[model samples]
Target: MTTYLPPEVQAGLDDARKRALKKSQRLSVQAGEETFRVLEAWDDGFALELAVADHLRGMVDLYDGPTLLSQCLIVASEEDGDQMRFEYKRMTEATGEQPVDFEKPENAPVALIGKG
Candidate 1:
């Protein structure tokens, strides 16, 4: 059997799917002082709402809610409808500060057991 949905029903379903995706992601991009909701994210790059001008290039930070995921230098890749794709020029994971003490013999030159 085959079933077909009305045009309006299809549109409503599509809108609901988009909203669910955005809510499930819980991700945002911080560019300068402005933040934008991320439509989707992958290992090498991510997509943002098509709000900025074309050919955007700069450093942006990706965040999972309040926690920062990484700092990335991005170049606009393409635009699909209301979403814009960006490819990462460079990506650096956010690192935490570590205190070093030269006075301690165990930490004389810093530990490197599993830092490879």
Candidate 2:
């Protein structure tokens, strides 16, 4: 079956992809027992939610420019009219680890376009 995402969600994802390409940097996030790169991010109004694969080990890290922020998980397209939300508890747990591998092309999430 085809997965259908809300229009807002799609727009958020698209914005994230553009941002990632423009920065030319990969993001690392921890899921369960591994670290993975967030192929793309979806705007959820609060924070930018990332679409991640594998690398699910400890906690997720979000790097913007020279600053690196940690969070448990990134949620996208939240109804709160925000970009994303970070779970502080999870982020504090994982520290000092190798960067996760972000599988490009195949693992990338779909971007969305905001209306009005």
Candidate 3:
């Protein structure tokens, strides 16, 4: 069963879908000098439109807007009509933030215990 929508209505739906996709896809991937939007991501992998995935491989950087998130070596994992998934052969965090180890002596605050 199929319902026909007027051309204008169909166009409006298409526009809305595009806007939603743009809003939801907050991350981007950089391969060499080119960049592509990441449609979705997880700890091990991410997806991109098949057209974009075609040009990418090996080492790439993932970014959240202008901030670098991680560097990965990605290989194709799956593909469907319009999208492809990539699994990380390797991934490393690119963020400046480091995990805190409060127990580490170097991380402890410096103080003169008797002077205080």
Candidate 4:
């Protein structure tokens, strides 16, 4: 069965969609064995993205791989208008290994892996 959203809810979704499209930016990350790409980031603190398939399995293959799953987070700075920063992190996992840490530190090298 298909149920429709309430009018108010639909309106809210529409507004969010407009805002997201206006300020959307792409982001990518390499965590453990898999890479992640963030499709969009808006002025608001919401990120629309997806994780690479087989990421967890690839990590398991690595001896020193991160046990936690990797994700892409959006960081926005008004000072750098229209430019959103991509932050990477690993969430807690069932395994015992520590999660991979993600941060934006000065002097971190920025490179383009390839064309999306």
**lDDT values of the candidates?**
0.81, 0.47, 0.83, 0.40
Q: What is the lDDT of residue 101 in candidate 2?
A: 94
Worst 10 residues of 3 by lDDT: 107-116
List, residue by residue over 1-116, the lDDT tens digit for candidate 3.
88999999988996686467668988999998889888778889988888657657899999999989888999988885567888999999885767877657766677656755
Model 2: lowest-lDDT 10 consecutive positions: 75-84
How does each model score on TM-score? 0.71, 0.26, 0.68, 0.21
Per-residue CA lDDT of model 4 for 23-79, tens digit only, reads: 453333354545444344333322223222222221221111333333333333222
Residues 26-47, candidate 1, lDDT per residue (tens digit)? Answer: 8888888878778888887888
Q: How accurate is candidate 2 locally (lDDT)?
A: 0.47
Indicate whether candidate 1 or candidate 2 has the larger TM-score: 1
Q: How many Å off is the CA of 92 in candidate 1? A: 1.4
Better of 1 and 4 by lDDT: 1
Q: Which scores greater on TM-score, model 1 or model 4?
A: 1
In the range 1-116, model 2's lDDT, one tens digit per residue, is 98999999999997886576545545545445554444444442123333433112234556544356555554332322322333243333335766679645876668977898
Please give the range of 10 consecutive residues that has the lowest summed lDDT in model 1. Answer: 102-111
By lDDT, who's the top model here?
A: 3
